[model samples]
Target: MAYKKEHVKERFRPKPGKLLDQVREVMHYHHYAIRTEKTYIKWILDYIRFNGTRHPREMGKPEIERFLSHLAVNRKLAPSTQNQALHAIIFLYKYVLDMPLNDYIDATRSKKQKRLPRVLSQSEISEFFKHISGTKELMAKLLYGSGLRLMECIRLRVKDVDFENHQIIARDGKGGKDRATVLPKPIREDLRLHLKGVRKLFEQDLAEGRADVYMPHALAKKYSGAGKSWLWQWVFPAKNYSKDPRTKKIRRHHAHETGLQKAVANAAKKAGINKRVGPHVLRHSFATHMLEAGKDIRRVQELLGHADVRTTMIYTNVMITNFETLGSPLDNLDND
Candidate 1:
């Protein structure tokens, strides 16, 4: 029985490599998203560096607690950021190193901040659009018009947009869930014109034998040539080809999110809107305006692809309130 147990442990041990490489191998074996893999690897590296380059196997729960506490107390990271680091370290120890942490990690937890989502007024939305043009304008419109998250908009494929049904399918959205969202009728023609250009790029890539886009999960193997097909092409392809970070194969990816992020920031400054703005602010505006127009909260929740109605309910708190109809108590007292 002792010999059998040792044999089993040897058979399941991780392949020999540097620790980060081993982490990547284990993460890939579990089918983690590339973004998630990158995030986890970064945090794990930070954890190792914080502990004076000590091997993680040498340090355990107390070291983790101190690192997390430092992030909360010294670095002043948000609660979410601290949680991310904790999760990353946990993944490293538990999965890659086969060292599950103890239940109690007494880290100084970061306080969760209760902040409202920033939304743009309908008039402000119009003003913001006036300053943005070209592809960024269309992308911004999708954020407001379709209630898409920034990554969702960036990652859209050619077949995801359904003009006939007047809906956009957000495939593998947040939480790896798929949902359909509205496609504003007003932007249909603009979207079609934009696709005509994307189609040309697709054809060019095909002629050069470089048309493949990244496929999710086992689909690349299941379908074989689907990655090279028109249906899988990015709706918003990058201006130039680049090497895939993981595969090292040169291909055109979807446009970088930073371009739209910078555009939104610059447009907000140019339009003179005071509040901090980003791509997500447009999504918040979409939810708020939808509710303001008497749209059902349930319907808005579906459109936003929120897992819970409570998550959508936060918009109600920030929705426009009519002041004229509900005047102050001083007005009822006949002030003046």
Candidate 2:
């Protein structure tokens, strides 16, 4: 009897290096975001150190549970943070080591808390803007007007802003989804002048032979020279060239989020609003204000790029409630 030839597939093996390096190799192969790559690396390193430098392949579910329990009980890590650490370790074992964890991991979990997002009143927003000027001011306006997250506004490419259609295409937003949002008409001319300056900066970079901007996914490899194109240039490019953390190539990146964050905080303090404020408060204010204007909740959900309407519904809880209009029953009781 003749037996048919059986074909066996070989498992993936990373290039020989340090353990962390092999983890990075797998992450890079999967095209993880730079921020995600850094975060996962940090978590993975923390997990290994917590295990007393034991190889992950040598340990399994119980060790994983113990490490996570420590994070919850001792470190007091939030549910999201503990979960992130768990995911990083799972990636190390499943992807890099080719050892899939088949058993359930019943780790001690941090309890999730419900908190309402802080929102600014219209007058407070106006007062806040009075303190911030120049590039940061434009960014702040976009956050309130276009309902963009801080990084979405920062990572915006030149082509993403469509003045003709009065929309800004927010690409690769949370969950890697794209959505269009309103571009405030009041700032169009200011944005135009801003782009003129950005264009001049782009020209200068090209003249110096360092015009490349970071491209997402395989676009850099597929397009090859597209990174140097003006259309692909960052709307808010960093003032100085910095080495790419992954590639080590000198290139200009988007403006750091911390600068804008600090600017917003300072502006809030200067405006003398009592509640805590940051760049995201502007976004929250935008959502609440839009709803206050009687804009449809579903439409607001689309603009905010929330995957669930329930996430968008949180804004309704904080919407302005005029207690005086309701009239207290005590007022109805005549004073004898």
Candidate 3:
């Protein structure tokens, strides 16, 4: 008695599902990063909504190509946006349905345009700082003086700060590469006071059996007891505690970046900044101002942790106003 062909086919097919988490789990199985998981899930959702609730398994390569192409051509999206969507769909087919790519795709890929980033001047930065007050002032100082990204500033751990060495070790920074930056001398006293407050909080949490913070990926795997230790505590602890997604353990993490963002936004408005200002403006100010102070470009590049000096040179163009006093552009202007 042989089984029916339809029954065998149904059993072999991938288990159909509607819940988003099910699809997300398939992407996670490949050890893809959190950003990739988020992007892939979002694109899959967009693909579904774009076609008015069409099932992904039912759709073939043509439909996927059409969606990606539509994003590039119809939506007039930047190349990065289109490529992000492309990655999401690629993950969908490659991991979710166990389908290989590289067949029957007529997607139009957007080309990335090379554009220079905007930078701020030292005086402009000072003016910007004068308008900012409270915690935002410190956050700005860390961003500009340390050349830290906003997330990096917030994510800084207690142990990462080396007051004796006058350096701050940035762990799991952009690209998961660790590097050290100069800790501003001006803020050391204030920073010490701030950390004292953090230490007090740590003591309170320790008393309540809630001292542990987020740990390194392998650390959590190696020692189950490590999550509750003082060394694992976040230097800039979050107001609330959260359970680690990987370890299912509660720990205090860093302050939320959103709070800092909103604070900066409000401060910028009060400061009367005509141009748009953001947490990143401090970073732009850092690189540009360092170059203005006769610091060697290569040294600035090293301090910025740029992979290529050419990327760092873009600030030279942003600093055009600085050269206005270079023996005067009007020295020859009168004769001309």
Candidate 4:
């Protein structure tokens, strides 16, 4: 006797309240980054909650369009943010719910404007450093020196730093790509001394049988012992241990990004040379300064891990040489 098709389908379907878990399992199977998994899940949950907890199985393209329009017209989300939410919903329909979205989604798209990045002068950078001290100060130097995004600087591990070569191997940067950037000579000794303190902390953690730090890509399972090793430890470990959601393993993760951001903001305010400075401003300053110092634009693109040269070209607009090189037609008329 043959089994019924409906019975087979029912056996395979997820049980109630397990839909999100299924989404996570699919995301993990495809090797989506942890951040992406979190973001997608958040948007999906918000979408469900916004529609009075209606199952996505009952929703279609029309519902998705209205939700996206609400985000733009009501929440005033950035275009990028609105687009991200749309992608998350699309993924849910296509993958999780097994429903296909239309080729075109009609919605009120958030209007995004082009804005030039803010850069700090060399003197302003010097003043900004005066207010921050210790680890926060070192982190700022790394951001400006290496042109690292805030997450890239904080996510660094011991193995990623190359002192002898004067470079930093930034792993899993934006768009899930890696690139190398120069590690300024001025911060080398300070970084070395800071590592000495981190090493002591790691030793203490090991003594307490809690040396394990968070590892990605199932690396902890593959190596079995790498998570507890000094080489894989966070270069900037958090002061306290937290429970990992998946494994419930108590581990010391990286320093929270917000803490460093707030520290930088306070430092900028204390220095009183404000042009809306933040950790990212330091990165912008790095790219702009490299261009000003005659570094090749292509080389800057590589160091900054920009996928397109056009993104790096934005710095050229803010460079002082653009004005310095300009000569008015009135000035040239003197020759006539």
Q: Estimate each model's TM-score.
A: 0.93, 0.94, 0.82, 0.88
Q: What residue runs in model 2 are displaced by over 4 Å at the alpha carbon?
A: 1-12, 329-336
Which lDDT tens digits does candidate 2 get at residues 1-336? Answer: 011121213446899889888988877777778888789899888878899988887888888899999999999988888888877777777778888777788888887788999999999998999999999999999999999999999999999999999999999998789999999999999999999999999999999999999999889999999999999999999999999988999989999999999999999999999988988999999999999999999999999999999999999999999989988989899888
The pairs that clash in candidate 1 are none
RMSD after CA superposition, every candidate: 5.0, 5.9, 7.5, 6.4
* Model 1 spans with C-alpha error above 4 angstroms: 1-13, 332-336
Tens digits of per-residue lDDT, candidate 3, 1-336, equal 011111111112234665466565554443445656677778889987887788776776778778887888788888767766766666566555656465656778765577766566556677777777766678778988988888789878777889999998877666567888889999999888888888888889888988766656456568887766655566677888887664577867678888888877777777666767778877877888888787899988877778789988988877656355667666778664
**Model 1, span 1-336: residue lDDT tens:** 000011112213569989998988877666678899999999998999999999999999888999999999999999889988888887787778888775678899888788899999999999999899999999999999999999999999999999999999999897779999999988999999999999999999999999999888778889999999999999999999999877899999999999999999999999999989999999999999999999999999999999999999999999998889978888879557
- Candidate 3 segments whose C-alpha is farther than 4 A from its true place: 1-19, 26-36, 103-106, 111-114, 242-251, 322-336
The TM-score obtained by model 1 is: 0.93
Candidate 3 lDDT score at position 123: 60
Over 1-336, each residue of candidate 4 has an lDDT whose tens digit, in order, gives: 011111111212333467799787667655567788899999999998888899899877777788889999999999889988887787767666667575578888888878999998888899999999999999999999999999999999999999989999999888779999998999999999999999999999999999988878768679999988999988899999998766788878899999899999999999997578889999999999999999999999999999999999999988866554786777667665
Worst 10 residues of 4 by lDDT: 1-10
Count of clashing residue pairs in every prediction: 0, 0, 1, 0
3 or 4, greater by TM-score? 4
Top-TM-score structure, candidate number:
2
How much is the lDDT of residue 131 in candidate 1?
97
| Clashing residue pairs, backbone N/CA/C < 3 A, model 4 | none
